[model samples]
Target: MQYSIGELAHRTGLTVKAVRFYSDRGLVPPSGRNAAGQRRYDDAALARLDVIRVLRDLGIDLATIRRVIEGETTVAEVAAEHVAAVEAQIGVLHRRRAVLNAVANRSQPEEASLAHQRLLLSEVERQCLIGDFLADALGDRPELAGIARTLTPELPGDPSPEQVQAWTELAALMRDTDFRANLRRLVDAHEGGLRRDLAAEVRDAVTPALVAGIGPKSPAARAIVDGLGRDPGELREWLDAVSDPRRERYLELLGVINGWAAPESMAPAFGWLAEVMAA
Candidate 1:
Protein backbone atom coordinates (compact mmCIF):
# COMPACT_ATOMS: atom_id res chain seq x y z
CA MET A 1 0.00 0.00 0.00
CA GLN A 2 1.14 3.54 -0.74
CA TYR A 3 1.46 6.24 1.96
CA SER A 4 2.12 9.96 1.81
CA ILE A 5 5.11 11.56 3.63
CA GLY A 6 2.97 12.56 6.64
CA GLU A 7 1.36 9.12 6.87
CA LEU A 8 4.72 7.40 6.65
CA ALA A 9 6.15 9.66 9.40
CA HIS A 10 3.05 9.06 11.59
CA ARG A 11 3.36 5.28 11.17
CA THR A 12 7.13 5.31 11.83
CA GLY A 13 6.80 7.65 14.88
CA LEU A 14 9.24 10.07 13.29
CA THR A 15 8.73 13.80 12.81
CA VAL A 16 7.56 14.76 9.32
CA LYS A 17 10.65 16.95 8.92
CA ALA A 18 12.92 14.05 9.87
CA VAL A 19 11.20 11.72 7.41
CA ARG A 20 11.50 14.39 4.72
CA PHE A 21 15.15 14.88 5.53
CA TYR A 22 15.77 11.16 5.25
CA SER A 23 14.03 11.24 1.87
CA ASP A 24 16.15 14.17 0.72
CA ARG A 25 19.31 12.39 1.89
CA GLY A 26 18.33 9.39 -0.25
CA LEU A 27 18.18 7.12 2.77
CA VAL A 28 14.50 6.38 2.13
CA PRO A 29 13.37 6.75 -1.48
CA PRO A 30 9.81 7.41 -2.56
CA SER A 31 7.98 4.55 -4.22
CA GLY A 32 5.98 6.91 -6.44
CA ARG A 33 4.45 10.41 -6.49
CA ASN A 34 0.85 11.39 -5.81
CA ALA A 35 -1.29 13.40 -8.27
CA ALA A 36 -0.20 16.81 -6.84
CA GLY A 37 3.51 15.65 -6.93
CA GLN A 38 3.68 14.94 -3.21
CA ARG A 39 6.00 12.04 -2.33
CA ARG A 40 4.43 8.68 -1.53
CA TYR A 41 6.29 5.71 -0.02
CA ASP A 42 5.71 2.00 0.20
CA ASP A 43 6.59 -0.62 2.85
CA ALA A 44 10.22 -0.61 1.60
CA ALA A 45 10.62 3.07 2.41
CA LEU A 46 9.11 2.56 5.87
CA ALA A 47 11.52 -0.28 6.57
CA ARG A 48 14.48 1.79 5.38
CA LEU A 49 13.42 4.70 7.63
CA ASP A 50 13.22 2.35 10.61
CA VAL A 51 16.79 1.17 9.98
CA ILE A 52 18.00 4.77 9.81
CA ARG A 53 16.35 5.56 13.14
CA VAL A 54 17.89 2.54 14.81
CA LEU A 55 21.33 3.32 13.43
CA ARG A 56 21.14 6.98 14.47
CA ASP A 57 20.08 5.98 17.98
CA LEU A 58 23.04 3.66 18.16
CA GLY A 59 25.35 6.69 17.76
CA ILE A 60 26.12 6.08 14.10
CA ASP A 61 26.53 9.27 12.13
CA LEU A 62 24.21 10.03 9.23
CA ALA A 63 26.94 9.29 6.73
CA THR A 64 27.49 5.80 8.08
CA ILE A 65 23.76 5.26 8.51
CA ARG A 66 23.31 6.17 4.89
CA ARG A 67 25.98 3.67 3.95
CA VAL A 68 24.22 0.98 5.96
CA ILE A 69 20.86 1.83 4.45
CA GLU A 70 22.37 1.70 0.98
CA GLY A 71 23.93 -1.73 1.72
CA GLU A 72 27.39 -0.29 1.12
CA THR A 73 28.40 -2.05 4.35
CA THR A 74 26.80 -4.67 6.55
CA VAL A 75 24.86 -3.51 9.64
CA ALA A 76 27.01 -5.68 11.88
CA GLU A 77 30.21 -4.07 10.59
CA VAL A 78 28.90 -0.54 11.07
CA ALA A 79 27.47 -1.33 14.49
CA ALA A 80 30.78 -2.79 15.67
CA GLU A 81 32.75 0.22 14.46
CA HIS A 82 30.34 2.64 16.18
CA VAL A 83 30.42 0.67 19.41
CA ALA A 84 34.21 1.02 19.57
CA ALA A 85 33.97 4.74 18.84
CA VAL A 86 31.36 5.24 21.55
CA GLU A 87 33.50 3.33 24.03
CA ALA A 88 36.50 5.58 23.31
CA GLN A 89 34.35 8.69 23.79
CA ILE A 90 33.04 7.28 27.07
CA GLY A 91 36.62 6.71 28.28
CA VAL A 92 37.54 10.34 27.54
CA LEU A 93 34.47 11.65 29.38
CA HIS A 94 35.23 9.41 32.33
CA ARG A 95 38.77 10.81 32.64
CA ARG A 96 37.45 14.37 32.33
CA ARG A 97 34.85 13.76 35.02
CA ALA A 98 37.49 12.33 37.34
CA VAL A 99 39.60 15.44 36.84
CA LEU A 100 36.67 17.78 37.54
CA ASN A 101 35.74 15.88 40.67
CA ALA A 102 39.33 16.11 41.88
CA VAL A 103 39.31 19.86 41.30
CA ALA A 104 36.06 20.17 43.21
CA ASN A 105 37.43 18.14 46.11
CA ARG A 106 40.25 20.67 46.67
CA SER A 107 38.08 23.78 46.11
CA GLN A 108 41.03 25.28 44.28
CA PRO A 109 41.14 28.79 42.87
CA GLU A 110 40.44 29.45 39.20
CA GLU A 111 44.13 29.57 38.38
CA ALA A 112 44.72 26.20 40.02
CA SER A 113 41.77 24.77 38.12
CA LEU A 114 43.22 26.04 34.86
CA ALA A 115 46.62 24.68 35.73
CA HIS A 116 45.21 21.25 36.43
CA GLN A 117 43.25 21.36 33.22
CA ARG A 118 46.37 22.14 31.23
CA LEU A 119 48.00 18.99 32.57
CA LEU A 120 45.21 16.68 31.37
CA LEU A 121 47.39 15.38 28.57
CA SER A 122 46.56 12.37 26.45
CA GLU A 123 48.71 9.21 26.63
CA VAL A 124 50.85 10.34 23.72
CA GLU A 125 51.63 13.69 25.33
CA ARG A 126 52.58 12.01 28.58
CA GLN A 127 54.93 9.61 26.82
CA CYS A 128 56.48 12.39 24.75
CA LEU A 129 57.10 14.53 27.81
CA ILE A 130 58.91 11.74 29.63
CA GLY A 131 60.70 10.41 26.58
CA ASP A 132 62.02 13.79 25.53
CA PHE A 133 63.13 14.69 29.02
CA LEU A 134 65.07 11.44 29.49
CA ALA A 135 66.46 11.56 25.97
CA ASP A 136 67.84 15.04 26.50
CA ALA A 137 69.28 14.14 29.91
CA LEU A 138 70.67 10.62 29.43
CA GLY A 139 70.39 9.66 25.76
CA ASP A 140 74.07 10.11 24.89
CA ARG A 141 75.37 8.36 28.01
CA PRO A 142 75.20 4.60 27.41
CA GLU A 143 75.42 3.84 31.12
CA LEU A 144 72.47 6.03 32.13
CA ALA A 145 70.12 5.18 29.25
CA GLY A 146 68.74 2.08 30.95
CA ILE A 147 68.43 3.87 34.27
CA ALA A 148 66.36 6.58 32.58
CA ARG A 149 63.67 4.08 31.60
CA THR A 150 63.62 2.67 35.13
CA LEU A 151 62.86 6.10 36.53
CA THR A 152 59.94 6.80 34.20
CA PRO A 153 56.48 7.05 35.77
CA GLU A 154 53.35 5.62 34.26
CA LEU A 155 49.97 6.84 35.51
CA PRO A 156 47.48 4.29 36.76
CA GLY A 157 44.42 3.25 34.79
CA ASP A 158 42.10 4.70 37.42
CA PRO A 159 44.12 7.50 38.94
CA SER A 160 43.42 8.97 42.36
CA PRO A 161 43.10 12.68 43.14
CA GLU A 162 46.67 12.74 44.39
CA GLN A 163 47.82 11.16 41.16
CA VAL A 164 46.01 13.76 39.13
CA GLN A 165 47.56 16.59 41.12
CA ALA A 166 51.02 15.06 40.94
CA TRP A 167 50.77 14.53 37.21
CA THR A 168 49.67 18.12 36.73
CA GLU A 169 52.67 19.40 38.64
CA LEU A 170 55.08 17.06 36.86
CA ALA A 171 53.79 18.12 33.46
CA ALA A 172 54.39 21.74 34.40
CA LEU A 173 57.92 20.94 35.54
CA MET A 174 58.70 19.01 32.36
CA ARG A 175 57.64 21.92 30.18
CA ASP A 176 59.97 24.42 31.85
CA THR A 177 62.86 24.98 29.44
CA ASP A 178 65.18 26.27 32.13
CA PHE A 179 64.38 23.42 34.44
CA ARG A 180 65.12 20.98 31.61
CA ALA A 181 68.48 22.63 30.93
CA ASN A 182 69.38 22.58 34.63
CA LEU A 183 68.45 18.91 34.92
CA ARG A 184 70.63 18.20 31.89
CA ARG A 185 73.55 20.00 33.50
CA LEU A 186 73.07 18.05 36.71
CA VAL A 187 73.05 14.76 34.81
CA ASP A 188 76.14 15.74 32.84
CA ALA A 189 78.04 16.69 35.98
CA HIS A 190 77.19 13.37 37.57
CA GLU A 191 78.58 11.59 34.48
CA GLY A 192 82.01 12.20 36.06
CA GLY A 193 83.33 8.96 37.62
CA LEU A 194 83.84 10.33 41.13
CA ARG A 195 80.10 10.83 41.89
CA ARG A 196 78.33 8.64 39.35
CA ASP A 197 75.91 7.04 41.86
CA LEU A 198 76.21 9.79 44.49
CA ALA A 199 72.58 10.86 44.41
CA ALA A 200 71.11 7.38 44.75
CA GLU A 201 73.68 6.41 47.35
CA VAL A 202 72.97 9.54 49.37
CA ARG A 203 69.24 9.02 49.13
CA ASP A 204 69.72 5.54 50.55
CA ALA A 205 72.23 6.33 53.32
CA VAL A 206 70.85 9.71 54.41
CA THR A 207 67.30 8.47 54.67
CA PRO A 208 68.16 7.14 58.13
CA ALA A 209 69.46 10.51 59.31
CA LEU A 210 66.50 12.37 57.86
CA VAL A 211 64.24 9.97 59.74
CA ALA A 212 66.23 10.72 62.91
CA GLY A 213 65.63 14.49 62.43
CA ILE A 214 69.33 15.45 62.49
CA GLY A 215 69.95 19.03 61.35
CA PRO A 216 71.99 19.78 58.20
CA LYS A 217 75.11 21.07 59.97
CA SER A 218 75.04 18.81 63.03
CA PRO A 219 78.07 16.75 64.11
CA ALA A 220 75.93 13.61 63.78
CA ALA A 221 75.86 14.36 60.02
CA ARG A 222 79.52 13.37 59.93
CA ALA A 223 78.56 9.78 60.71
CA ILE A 224 76.20 9.67 57.73
CA VAL A 225 78.95 11.05 55.45
CA ASP A 226 81.52 8.58 56.77
CA GLY A 227 79.12 5.71 56.13
CA LEU A 228 78.90 6.69 52.46
CA GLY A 229 82.74 6.52 52.17
CA ARG A 230 82.99 10.07 50.78
CA ASP A 231 85.07 12.97 52.10
CA PRO A 232 82.92 15.44 54.02
CA GLY A 233 83.77 18.40 51.79
CA GLU A 234 82.99 16.58 48.54
CA LEU A 235 79.85 15.05 50.06
CA ARG A 236 78.60 18.50 51.02
CA GLU A 237 78.95 19.86 47.49
CA TRP A 238 77.21 16.85 45.97
CA LEU A 239 74.42 17.11 48.50
CA ASP A 240 73.92 20.78 47.73
CA ALA A 241 73.53 20.12 44.01
CA VAL A 242 71.68 16.80 44.06
CA SER A 243 69.41 17.05 47.08
CA ASP A 244 67.22 19.65 45.42
CA PRO A 245 63.84 20.22 47.05
CA ARG A 246 62.35 20.24 43.58
CA ARG A 247 63.90 16.88 42.70
CA GLU A 248 62.45 15.36 45.86
CA ARG A 249 59.16 16.95 44.94
CA TYR A 250 59.44 15.40 41.49
CA LEU A 251 59.85 11.88 42.96
CA GLU A 252 56.91 12.54 45.28
CA LEU A 253 54.85 13.53 42.28
CA LEU A 254 56.05 10.50 40.35
CA GLY A 255 54.99 8.20 43.16
CA VAL A 256 51.55 9.74 43.16
CA ILE A 257 51.20 9.22 39.42
CA ASN A 258 52.41 5.64 39.59
CA GLY A 259 50.42 4.78 42.75
CA TRP A 260 53.66 3.81 44.46
CA ALA A 261 54.37 4.30 48.14
CA ALA A 262 55.44 7.80 49.11
CA PRO A 263 59.20 7.99 49.47
CA GLU A 264 60.82 9.22 52.71
CA SER A 265 62.45 12.67 52.84
CA MET A 266 66.20 12.74 52.21
CA ALA A 267 66.48 16.41 53.08
CA PRO A 268 67.23 15.81 56.75
CA ALA A 269 70.09 13.47 56.02
CA PHE A 270 71.53 15.87 53.45
CA GLY A 271 70.99 18.74 55.88
CA TRP A 272 73.03 16.91 58.48
CA LEU A 273 75.72 16.13 55.95
CA ALA A 274 75.91 19.76 54.84
CA GLU A 275 76.24 20.93 58.43
CA VAL A 276 78.95 18.41 59.29
CA MET A 277 81.07 19.57 56.35
CA ALA A 278 80.71 23.25 57.37
CA ALA A 279 81.70 22.44 60.98
Candidate 2:
Protein backbone atom coordinates (compact mmCIF):
# COMPACT_ATOMS: atom_id res chain seq x y z
CA MET A 1 0.00 0.00 0.00
CA GLN A 2 1.23 3.54 -0.81
CA TYR A 3 0.75 6.71 1.29
CA SER A 4 1.12 10.34 0.22
CA ILE A 5 3.22 12.79 2.35
CA GLY A 6 0.16 14.07 4.22
CA GLU A 7 -1.16 10.56 4.84
CA LEU A 8 2.28 9.40 6.09
CA ALA A 9 2.50 12.38 8.45
CA HIS A 10 -1.02 11.77 9.84
CA ARG A 11 -0.45 8.02 10.29
CA THR A 12 2.88 8.59 12.07
CA GLY A 13 1.61 11.57 14.15
CA LEU A 14 4.42 13.78 12.72
CA THR A 15 4.07 17.19 11.05
CA VAL A 16 3.84 17.25 7.24
CA LYS A 17 6.77 19.66 7.24
CA ALA A 18 8.86 17.26 9.41
CA VAL A 19 8.04 14.34 7.14
CA ARG A 20 8.97 16.43 4.10
CA PHE A 21 12.21 17.43 5.81
CA TYR A 22 13.10 13.79 6.41
CA SER A 23 12.33 13.06 2.78
CA ASP A 24 14.61 15.92 1.66
CA ARG A 25 17.40 14.51 3.82
CA GLY A 26 16.84 11.14 2.11
CA LEU A 27 16.26 9.48 5.50
CA VAL A 28 12.83 8.45 4.35
CA PRO A 29 12.73 8.91 0.60
CA PRO A 30 9.47 8.06 -1.16
CA SER A 31 9.26 4.67 -2.86
CA GLY A 32 7.79 6.26 -6.05
CA ARG A 33 5.92 9.23 -7.46
CA ASN A 34 2.18 9.40 -8.03
CA ALA A 35 0.75 10.24 -11.54
CA ALA A 36 0.59 14.02 -10.73
CA GLY A 37 4.25 13.91 -9.45
CA GLN A 38 3.42 13.99 -5.72
CA ARG A 39 5.67 11.73 -3.54
CA ARG A 40 4.31 8.39 -2.34
CA TYR A 41 5.78 6.01 0.23
CA ASP A 42 5.49 2.24 0.72
CA ASP A 43 5.62 0.30 4.03
CA ALA A 44 9.47 0.30 3.91
CA ALA A 45 9.51 4.12 3.75
CA LEU A 46 7.17 4.36 6.73
CA ALA A 47 9.40 2.00 8.73
CA ARG A 48 12.46 4.14 7.87
CA LEU A 49 10.62 7.25 9.04
CA ASP A 50 9.80 5.58 12.36
CA VAL A 51 13.50 4.79 12.91
CA ILE A 52 14.54 8.34 12.00
CA ARG A 53 12.02 9.81 14.46
CA VAL A 54 13.35 7.63 17.28
CA LEU A 55 16.98 8.49 16.52
CA ARG A 56 16.26 12.23 16.26
CA ASP A 57 14.46 12.13 19.60
CA LEU A 58 17.50 10.43 21.06
CA GLY A 59 19.62 13.51 20.05
CA ILE A 60 21.27 11.82 17.07
CA ASP A 61 22.36 14.25 14.36
CA LEU A 62 21.19 13.92 10.76
CA ALA A 63 24.67 12.94 9.51
CA THR A 64 24.77 10.04 11.96
CA ILE A 65 21.27 9.11 10.96
CA ARG A 66 22.44 8.88 7.34
CA ARG A 67 25.34 6.63 8.38
CA VAL A 68 22.97 4.33 10.25
CA ILE A 69 20.55 4.22 7.32
CA GLU A 70 23.39 3.37 4.90
CA GLY A 71 24.58 0.52 7.16
CA GLU A 72 27.93 2.32 7.42
CA THR A 73 27.63 2.30 11.25
CA THR A 74 25.41 0.46 13.70
CA VAL A 75 22.79 2.28 15.75
CA ALA A 76 24.56 0.92 18.85
CA GLU A 77 27.91 2.52 17.85
CA VAL A 78 26.39 5.94 17.19
CA ALA A 79 24.35 5.84 20.38
CA ALA A 80 27.41 4.90 22.44
CA GLU A 81 29.48 7.78 21.05
CA HIS A 82 26.55 10.15 21.62
CA VAL A 83 26.28 8.98 25.21
CA ALA A 84 29.94 9.85 25.82
CA ALA A 85 29.50 13.29 24.27
CA VAL A 86 26.42 13.92 26.44
CA GLU A 87 28.31 12.93 29.60
CA ALA A 88 31.14 15.41 28.81
CA GLN A 89 28.57 18.14 28.14
CA ILE A 90 26.92 17.36 31.46
CA GLY A 91 30.25 17.70 33.29
CA VAL A 92 30.83 21.14 31.81
CA LEU A 93 27.31 22.24 32.77
CA HIS A 94 27.75 21.12 36.36
CA ARG A 95 30.99 23.11 36.73
CA ARG A 96 29.37 26.18 35.27
CA ARG A 97 26.46 25.85 37.68
CA ALA A 98 28.84 25.55 40.60
CA VAL A 99 30.68 28.67 39.52
CA LEU A 100 27.41 30.56 39.21
CA ASN A 101 26.28 29.43 42.63
CA ALA A 102 29.55 30.65 44.11
CA VAL A 103 29.20 34.00 42.41
CA ALA A 104 25.67 34.37 43.72
CA ASN A 105 26.70 33.54 47.27
CA ARG A 106 29.34 36.27 47.15
CA SER A 107 27.25 38.83 45.25
CA GLN A 108 29.92 39.15 42.61
CA PRO A 109 29.44 41.11 39.38
CA GLU A 110 27.26 39.82 36.56
CA GLU A 111 30.21 39.99 34.19
CA ALA A 112 30.85 36.36 35.11
CA SER A 113 27.31 35.25 34.29
CA LEU A 114 27.35 31.48 33.97
CA ALA A 115 27.28 31.13 30.20
CA HIS A 116 29.96 33.80 29.68
CA GLN A 117 32.31 32.33 32.30
CA ARG A 118 31.90 28.77 31.04
CA LEU A 119 32.73 29.83 27.53
CA LEU A 120 35.69 31.99 28.57
CA LEU A 121 37.51 29.93 31.19
CA SER A 122 38.42 26.27 31.61
CA GLU A 123 40.29 24.87 34.61
CA VAL A 124 43.46 24.34 32.57
CA GLU A 125 43.32 27.82 31.11
CA ARG A 126 42.73 29.25 34.57
CA GLN A 127 45.79 27.51 35.97
CA CYS A 128 47.98 28.44 33.00
CA LEU A 129 47.02 32.09 33.37
CA ILE A 130 48.01 32.14 37.04
CA GLY A 131 51.20 30.25 36.22
CA ASP A 132 52.12 33.05 33.83
CA PHE A 133 51.70 35.62 36.61
CA LEU A 134 53.85 33.62 39.01
CA ALA A 135 56.65 33.21 36.48
CA ASP A 136 56.63 36.92 35.72
CA ALA A 137 56.66 37.94 39.39
CA LEU A 138 59.21 35.50 40.75
CA GLY A 139 61.79 35.61 37.94
CA ASP A 140 64.59 33.04 38.59
CA ARG A 141 64.81 33.24 42.36
CA PRO A 142 65.47 29.62 43.41
CA GLU A 143 64.61 30.22 47.07
CA LEU A 144 61.19 31.68 46.23
CA ALA A 145 60.22 28.99 43.64
CA GLY A 146 58.95 26.58 46.26
CA ILE A 147 56.84 29.36 47.78
CA ALA A 148 55.55 30.13 44.31
CA ARG A 149 54.47 26.50 43.70
CA THR A 150 52.79 26.24 47.08
CA LEU A 151 50.91 29.45 46.41
CA THR A 152 49.55 28.12 43.10
CA PRO A 153 45.86 27.19 43.36
CA GLU A 154 45.05 23.74 41.99
CA LEU A 155 41.31 23.38 41.37
CA PRO A 156 40.02 19.86 41.86
CA GLY A 157 38.15 17.87 39.19
CA ASP A 158 35.10 18.26 41.45
CA PRO A 159 35.68 21.44 43.40
CA SER A 160 33.41 22.86 46.06
CA PRO A 161 31.59 26.14 45.46
CA GLU A 162 33.90 28.00 47.81
CA GLN A 163 36.93 26.78 45.89
CA VAL A 164 35.41 28.12 42.68
CA GLN A 165 34.82 31.52 44.27
CA ALA A 166 38.29 31.60 45.77
CA TRP A 167 39.83 30.75 42.41
CA THR A 168 37.89 33.57 40.77
CA GLU A 169 39.01 36.19 43.29
CA LEU A 170 42.62 34.99 43.19
CA ALA A 171 42.62 35.30 39.41
CA ALA A 172 41.41 38.87 39.73
CA LEU A 173 44.02 39.71 42.35
CA MET A 174 46.87 38.28 40.28
CA ARG A 175 45.87 40.32 37.27
CA ASP A 176 46.49 43.62 39.06
CA THR A 177 49.77 45.17 37.90
CA ASP A 178 50.43 46.83 41.26
CA PHE A 179 49.72 43.57 43.06
CA ARG A 180 52.25 41.82 40.83
CA ALA A 181 54.94 44.42 41.53
CA ASN A 182 54.22 44.30 45.27
CA LEU A 183 54.45 40.52 45.26
CA ARG A 184 57.75 40.66 43.42
CA ARG A 185 59.09 43.01 46.05
CA LEU A 186 57.82 40.74 48.84
CA VAL A 187 59.44 37.74 47.17
CA ASP A 188 62.73 39.59 46.74
CA ALA A 189 62.75 40.48 50.42
CA HIS A 190 61.96 36.86 51.30
CA GLU A 191 64.74 35.60 49.00
CA GLY A 192 67.39 37.35 51.04
CA GLY A 193 66.21 35.66 54.28
CA LEU A 194 67.26 38.83 56.15
CA ARG A 195 63.83 40.48 55.97
CA ARG A 196 62.05 37.38 57.20
CA ASP A 197 64.64 36.75 59.92
CA LEU A 198 64.45 40.35 61.07
CA ALA A 199 60.66 40.37 61.08
CA ALA A 200 60.67 37.16 63.08
CA GLU A 201 63.09 38.66 65.59
CA VAL A 202 61.07 41.86 65.98
CA ARG A 203 57.80 39.89 66.30
CA ASP A 204 59.30 37.66 68.95
CA ALA A 205 60.54 40.65 70.90
CA VAL A 206 57.57 43.01 70.52
CA THR A 207 54.62 40.59 70.53
CA PRO A 208 54.92 40.48 74.33
CA ALA A 209 55.05 44.27 74.49
CA LEU A 210 52.19 44.52 71.97
CA VAL A 211 50.15 42.09 74.05
CA ALA A 212 50.89 44.07 77.20
CA GLY A 213 49.41 47.19 75.61
CA ILE A 214 52.73 48.99 75.55
CA GLY A 215 52.25 51.74 72.98
CA PRO A 216 54.50 51.52 69.90
CA LYS A 217 56.07 54.96 70.38
CA SER A 218 56.44 54.46 74.16
CA PRO A 219 59.82 53.83 75.81
CA ALA A 220 59.00 50.15 76.43
CA ALA A 221 58.37 49.51 72.68
CA ARG A 222 61.74 51.21 71.95
CA ALA A 223 63.41 49.01 74.58
CA ILE A 224 61.93 45.88 72.93
CA VAL A 225 63.32 47.01 69.56
CA ASP A 226 66.72 47.76 71.12
CA GLY A 227 66.95 44.14 72.37
CA LEU A 228 66.31 42.49 68.94
CA GLY A 229 70.08 42.95 68.18
CA ARG A 230 69.48 44.00 64.54
CA ASP A 231 70.16 47.34 62.90
CA PRO A 232 67.04 49.42 63.44
CA GLY A 233 67.54 51.05 60.03
CA GLU A 234 67.34 47.78 58.03
CA LEU A 235 64.38 46.54 60.06
CA ARG A 236 62.56 49.86 59.49
CA GLU A 237 63.04 49.63 55.70
CA TRP A 238 61.70 46.03 55.60
CA LEU A 239 58.73 47.00 57.76
CA ASP A 240 57.79 49.89 55.45
CA ALA A 241 57.94 47.76 52.28
CA VAL A 242 56.12 44.63 53.49
CA SER A 243 53.30 46.31 55.44
CA ASP A 244 51.22 46.87 52.29
CA PRO A 245 47.52 46.01 52.68
CA ARG A 246 47.50 44.20 49.33
CA ARG A 247 50.21 41.87 50.58
CA GLU A 248 47.99 40.89 53.51
CA ARG A 249 44.99 40.48 51.19
CA TYR A 250 46.96 38.25 48.85
CA LEU A 251 47.76 35.95 51.79
CA GLU A 252 44.09 35.92 52.84
CA LEU A 253 42.96 34.99 49.32
CA LEU A 254 45.71 32.38 49.05
CA GLY A 255 44.50 30.76 52.27
CA VAL A 256 40.98 30.57 50.87
CA ILE A 257 42.14 28.91 47.64
CA ASN A 258 44.46 26.40 49.33
CA GLY A 259 41.99 25.54 52.11
CA TRP A 260 44.58 26.61 54.67
CA ALA A 261 43.88 28.09 58.08
CA ALA A 262 43.79 31.87 57.67
CA PRO A 263 47.16 33.13 58.72
CA GLU A 264 46.99 35.90 61.31
CA SER A 265 47.90 39.28 59.87
CA MET A 266 51.05 40.70 61.53
CA ALA A 267 50.32 44.14 60.11
CA PRO A 268 49.37 45.58 63.48
CA ALA A 269 52.56 44.38 65.07
CA PHE A 270 54.66 45.54 62.12
CA GLY A 271 52.90 48.89 62.07
CA TRP A 272 53.62 49.36 65.76
CA LEU A 273 57.28 48.54 65.18
CA ALA A 274 57.43 50.96 62.25
CA GLU A 275 55.98 53.66 64.53
CA VAL A 276 58.70 52.98 67.12
CA MET A 277 61.44 53.39 64.49
CA ALA A 278 59.96 56.66 63.25
CA ALA A 279 59.87 57.98 66.83
The number of the candidate with the highest lDDT is 2
Tens-digit lDDT string for candidate 1 (79-196): 7877767775776676676677677777549856675666566767778888887777566777786778666888765667777777778877777776666566567566543467
Query: lDDT scores for all predictions?
Result: 0.75, 0.77
Per-residue accuracy of model 2 over 135-200 as CA lDDT, tens digit each: 877876676777787777765545677767666667777778887887777666666554556657
Q: Show model 1 residue runs off by greater than 4 Å.
A: 106-112, 119-158, 189-197, 204-241, 272-279
lDDT of 1 at 111: 53
Model 2 residue runs over 4 Å out of place are 1-92, 104-120, 192-197
Residue 127, model 1: lDDT of 84
Model 1's alpha-carbon lDDT is: 0.75
Candidate 1, position 87, lDDT: 71
Residue pairs with backbone atoms closer than 3 Å in model 1 (clashes): 216-271, 216-272, 216-275, 217-275
Worst 10-residue lDDT window, candidate 2: 111-120
| Cα TM-score per model | 0.70, 0.61
